[model samples]
Target: MAVLVVLLGGASVAARLDDSSSDSAFPGRPDDAASAPLGAPAAGGTASDAYAFIATQKGGSDPVTYDPCAPIHLVVDARTIVDGGMKLLEQALDEVSEASGLQLVVDGLTDDEAPEGDAVTGPDRTWLPVTVTWSDPKASPKLKGDVAGYAGSSSIERDGHRWFVTGTVVLDGPQLKRILDQRGGRAGVRSVMMHELAHLVGLDHVDAAGQLMRPSGDESITTWGAGDRTGLAAVGSGRCIPY
Candidate 1:
């Protein structure tokens, strides 16, 4: 069975969200000419820089990544979202899209509950779009305590290659609301969203203090650092999968 790799945020940790789920029946690649990459990753950034991947290919450092040929669609659950939260999300997505060279589109809002496991299919047995939901500690235990948010992608092995198909990003509504009420809260909210989205795209936490991928949240660092950019570019440049 294909396993679900869940990369956590608000801390440096990686855990298997599910191991028994079967992803073998998911949909295959489209048959049309849309198989070509939507865009190429922004050039620059050296591998020698400070950066890390959430999961690397077996016996290799190549990060497991989404299919660059297709757009990564996201759906938001704004029920618990605070004012200006959606705007920050849009800004963060735009920044990540530019740095990674991947096309990300928000498919509007969803009524689906926050995902708690590795199941990637909706009621129709098709792959679900990346879900971005505002949640609380009671609803999502992973968001308990000081954790602000987390994101992870689920990948499946096919034709001897791994490709990320779908994922989820869960934000702590209360924690973020408190941050938004304080000074420089918007920057803080954007930083948290960007950090989690970085995880969604395969970037892992680093020890560098000034980098946005650092383990802890720091509102002072509003943009992706050098290492973060290097990692984003690498993951975004992953080999395109036609199937």
Candidate 2:
């Protein structure tokens, strides 16, 4: 199975964005690292020829997806801006939205923290705007290791469909900030943001190198590849749901 979770320490592993939802956890699957390289693809591999989408399970089952036709509102944790600020995040969001044809709205900053083990509450808890935050090792134990970020959403059984209502994205602030200061700068930060956002919208990691969904910190590949664009197109093409 193609891993849908982000990379941790260059290892293909699952990371959860929904701390409170049991279904949000990464499903048990074998690692695909051995099947593909973990670096940039061969030279001259254009997006048209290089990207790969997240894979789905076999048998008759509804693929987990967010309705691309609907507006996806997001709120960023104020502290996450210390590295490169919201500008980079916004840039990546725009790029992904354009590629996936999903409507994205920045709902402003929030003090609502993340990496929590409790359930989401308040008016926003019912599933509206997705939350993006920067977490220290204490807040996100996964970051204490090689995992740079975590992105996933919570769904509900409604209208006989499992609709994704809310999601959370947690980044390794210090690590990402350090990378931002390196040569890659904005592009590097944006790629990481895009990778997590990809997961937020139901994209899983791929073993192939160069795709934005690859579970590695390799900065050589700065944008989405061919497979990435294809997968994003599918994710964004999901059926619409009433607001």
Q: Largest TM-score belongs to which candidate?
A: 1
Error of 2 at 138 (Å): 2.3
- Per-model TM-score, in order, reads 0.85, 0.72
lDDT of 2: 0.61
Off by over 4 Å in 1: 1-26, 30-33, 44-48, 123-125
User: Model 1, 1-243: lDDT tens per residue?
Assistant: 211112255222222223324454646564421567787766665544777888888678788887888888899998789899889999999888888988888989999775556666566655568989998889889887778889888876655567677788899888889888777788888888998998998888888856888878566788888888888888888877754
List candidate 2 stretches off by more than 4 Å: 1-62, 115-126
**CA-lDDT, candidates in order:** 0.76, 0.61
Model 2 lDDT per residue over 137-208, tens place = 686787776677877776544334444546788887876777777775678778888888888776777767
Clashing pairs in 2: 4-204, 50-226, 51-225, 51-226, 51-227, 52-227, 52-228
Weakest 10 consecutive residues of candidate 2 by summed lDDT = 32-41
List the RMSD of every prediction in angstroms.
Answer: 6.5, 10.8
| Model 2 clash number | 7
